[model samples]
Target: MGVDNNSISVSLEKLERFIAAALRRAGLPEADAATVAGLMAQADLQGSDGHGIIRLPQYIRRIRSGGINVRPDIRVVADMPGMAIVDGDNGMGHLVVSRATELAIDKARTQGAAWVGTRRSNHAGPASLYSAMPLRHDMVGIYFAVGNANHLPPWGGTDMLLSTNPISVGVPAGDEPPVVLDMATTVAAYGKVKAKAKRGEMMPEGWMIDREGRPLLDPTRSDEGFLMPIGGHKGYGLALIVGLLAGTLNGAAMGRDVVDFNKDHVTPTNTGQAMLVLNLAAFGPVGGFKEAVDRLVGDLRGSARMPGTDRIWIPGEQSHARRQRYRETGIPVSRGVAAELDQLARELEIPPLA
Candidate 1:
């Protein structure tokens, strides 16, 4: 069902076209904006409602405010046979990082393995996109990102000083779907909660809580609370480790230096992210690795489930399935996000999604 101006239920094509038009109107190069627009659409296709077309307004704001460079010539800043650091030149995160991943895949093909890191990157839509790139070449890709904002705090501390950093991994198989694992360190991604809040819905208890350690289900009160990390101290540690690897190692922002892009768009974010591509040939036979991965994933999915689950499921199955469904149907956006996009389109004097 299509939603009114007060709501958002847009077809996949409409969302993509709207984003492309808006981005181009914002003065980004056509090809660059198109690339980013396609990835953002894919984020919606994969049921990443929080990371998909919802970000258009924020991206437009950044571009118009001079935070993102419309014509950035991304280049390698430091290099070796299997290691390199890329400079994003303040371009759209999606375009710059995807280019970096391509570089990583090319190097891995020749060097057996490769590690690529980036600085001056913006918040890319989703990490899985880059990590899934190498799989088409029979290689495994691992990705990590420094979240644009700090929402989670160090374990045992009340200060919100760390981001809910995310990691994604993809492995290719012969006949079965590739095993893709994409997740954030937080119990729930901040986007989901923001969406829930925008829709005036209550969040689950475990997603967030106030400083007094009480559950915060009311999205309106989210500001007074902070997101809880998954596995408590363990997720906190993972976020920290990823920050060190993706940020500090690349000479990008870390700790207090990270610019909260959502609040301030004029600052150079200096965000850091990294991707590692491993050619299967380096370890063993391609067929062997694929077979092993297939078996491993099959085993995991076959595990006995508790009463409520119905059946055990692997990480990426739900997302892939949802993508298929949404592609055939349409993306269901919340009322508030649609309004935000409309406002942005009006400001840019471009066509908006309907």
Candidate 2:
């Protein structure tokens, strides 16, 4: 590990090991701990610091409080030729969604397309992690999730009946990096606000607003405000549709029933998620499709820019660049997050992150 004034750079291997050790101490099985840790570390490697090891302490707290099932018997509760529903048994969301993604990829191989949904899961890492899973198999992946907490309300209402409700899509390219779009329907995800609070930073003006409809810039006072949607009423509509598909359709928690996992560590979140995979071979010649994608990406990148714009960026381009850069220089963790991890290490009686 390398330490600078404001942050620490730790190797991906060491970070994953530290996360796994903490989870194992929290009563997770060795294999499951390792699996979840890998995904969490990958989130940081891809520049999603909010969903990475920064969340390990919270996960450990939930496990110790008996809010999450460490030995959950995650299994398929409903099945069909092209679709399936999984019961997470209140397990960690990372493990549940990993299993669902694997199932979707397998089914898509034979069925051309497959949809898999999960209920009773817990908070996972970045949406892009699962959305990018099928890329290795030459498949397009789409994902949706009902957030663990409700932070938004209906378009002109103040009730807080909706969550961020994220969505992600991944498409493969021949020579260029894969296209992965992962984002919350809100202007910013709640995790970003929590991360800002952890860093003792203030949020931007448009991300949220107070009950009085004034801009809320203080992340520490996040509970007093609500997140703004992407396109006003339209984003709220998207969030509602996403919640219905990922939560209600799968018989999971949504709307008023969604628990605020941040405040209550003793309750099962019952988070819901869905994954859809489409095999490229099923559409047309895979090689031809990839070539076309490459050409399109090249055209987009080569397009003219405005006076101040540097260049056009494809979806997932920055994350792909970060993944490559982090592999060489290690992932960066802020000093605040490092201190929290250190505290967690002491509490768990485990070695601190190097």
lDDT of 2 by residue, 18-92 (tens): 999999999999999999999999999999998999899899889999999999999999999899999999999
Model 1 Cα lDDT, one tens digit per residue, 48-143: 877888888888889989999999989999999999999999989998789889999999998999999999989998788888889999999999
Candidate 1 backbone collisions, by pair: none
Against the true structure, whose TM-score is highest?
Answer: 2
Candidate 2: residue 165 lDDT (0-100) = 98
| Top of the candidates by lDDT | 2
Could you tally the backbone clashes for each prediction?
0, 0
RMSD per candidate (Å) reads 1.8, 0.7
